[model samples]
Target: MSCLLEVTALCKTYRKQHGLFRQETIKALENISFQLHAGKTLAIVGETGSGKSTLAKVLVGIEQPDQGEIRLAGKVVTMTNYRKYNHVIRYLFQDAERALNPSQKIGDMLTDVLRFSTVLDNLQRQQKVLESLQQVGLMDEHIDFYPHMFSAGQQQRIALARALILDPKLLILDEALTVLDPTLRAQIVNLLLELQQQKGLAYLLISKNLRLVRHISDHCIVMQHGQVVESGPTEQLLTQPQHAHTRKLMGMS
Candidate 1:
């Protein structure tokens, strides 16, 4: 598969306040680089504060990297022009419920996304929204429900439906399954895999869960202190981790 997204020499830093008139420069990401191909899964596994979320933010245009190159479909992309990429590359957050509008119906949520992202009129948008709902195994009637009414898994499905509405070439799953139970997590994992096969969708999965990485990702990168210390095929990296941090993360140490 040809690469859909390529990131090179990515670096980001932040000024974190420690005390009055005292601020510390923290490196959120350092020379991070990776690529994702069509229909492939790339897992970013690391401990908290390891810059995994930072990387995701950069990719989705929420955070701008001070130094780096981000190329989508072999074209350069900067934060200024990033909104144009949203339809092709969508970002999904960890907290599914919070990602949705508490006051909005499911249909409204989906419709709102469609309205902002596409040129479809109301009748056309509604048809697409219903199609998206069905694609995620949601009934059309459930579209009238609110976020609080669905099960955790169904909420995720609703989010998934919204992400799929644009038929994005890539979906960035930033700790997206962290809140679910094991069974629901597994179900979402399977749903993601199935969606990849069905839609030729690529994924950048951000999580600390090695088991989730092993189950869904084709390739994996392990980060520590804002740098990638180890990376390879998911099974090999998990089974024979080369970096100490990777071993410790996999509980091998």
Candidate 2:
């Protein structure tokens, strides 16, 4: 249960042209801070434009924070050294189909990850790919299938397999479960929890689904206007929200 990720005073801003000469500054995230531990899940729940997605992108190195510090396993993470941490922290996007290439077979796609990130030979990479597929409840037969060949749920499983291929300690899920139906979402949640227990994985879930956050997360933070309005243990925060924004999110009067 050691701390695996620490984010402090994270800030991000963007300037957009308003008119021919005027411009507007938008603060996406302001002084955001949090901690996540091994084998735990931390859920960020917010409305659209609340900066949840921005935080995900920053954590995964897709975007740089204007001012902040990110530490993984007590080591500072900067854009310059992000490549060293890429294998230890991975991202799973919401759209599995869009994240995957339709023309590539699942096996080749997975092998490519190992081919670049690892020193394993062809035989070793193939073995690792099969192992990763099995970790997400996929089978050997799925290795030859293209992205279009699977159902929405199965495609997500494949994406999960790819993320776990490198045996990452932290997985940032940017609305990864939002696209699935109730039943499929439940299945993926169970699978994710199982994987966490088995591999001691940590998850940073960016989502708007309150029910999913309550069920799967150990702690929850509610964001509004690009700031955290409330944060606490998941059950406590959900059942007894303190902030007006959080109450509104929960449909409370």
Candidate 3:
């Protein structure tokens, strides 16, 4: 498995104002570094304000890093060139419903990506949409339904379908399974695993759920106050966390 994504010395910050004269510099990420290979899963676990979401945003090009390097498929990724890499990397947010358009039918929503990003004709784009739906275990009939017409799990499947429509090498999942019920979560986990095996997809999972992280991730990184406090193979790190923050996060302290 080749290195699908590499991030090094990544840093991000924000400025906040208090009163009229005082300003605060918030460190959202600091010296973050990691690598993810094709068909592998890497989990980022941290409490709120730990910079997990900021890292995801940076990787997906929603936010730019103040400093650091991001390489996708061995090519440097920057704000100026991120558009060229969009088809190779995709993001799956926690809120599938909110991420989707309520007005557009499923097929239209999926087709829109192809329409704007590729040179596929109408018939070719339709075929690609149908293929994407099938990949996510959706039937062709469901393509005509609106977002509200589907259950939460199905809506998520639709979101996954759209993400997969581009055949991306990496998928950044930011608390993507947090809202689902236990049963649905398990189902989606299984589906995601299947898809990864079939598509050779690399996953960068952001979550606060230790159990979920342990179950799904091959490796794990624990973040606190914008830094990676501890990291290792998932099973080993969960059972034998070295950092105080990691132990506290796992309820081991």
Per-model TM-score on C-alpha atoms = 0.97, 0.98, 0.98
Off by over 4 Å in 1: none
What lDDT tens digits, residue by residue, belong to model 2 across residues 1-253? 5889999999999899978999999999999999999999999998889999999989989999999899999999999988789999999999998999999999999999998888999999999999999888999999999999999999999999999999999999999999999999999999999999998999999888888888899999888877988999999999889999998888886
Q: Model-by-model lDDT, in order?
A: 0.91, 0.93, 0.93
Candidate 3 on 1-253: residue-level lDDT in tens?
A: 6898999999999999999999999999999999999999999998899999999999889999999999988889989988778898899989999999999999899999998889999999999999999888899998899999999999899999998998999998999999999999999999999999988998999999999998889999999999999999999999888999998888888
Q: Could you tell me how far off, in angstroms, the CA of residue 101 lies in candidate 2 after the best superposition?
A: 0.4
Candidate 3 differs from the real structure by a C-alpha RMSD in angstroms, to one decimal, of 0.8
Q: In model 2, where do residues sit more than 4 Å from their true spots? A: none
Evaluate model 2: give its lDDT.
Answer: 0.93
In the predicted model 1, the residue pairs found to clash are: none
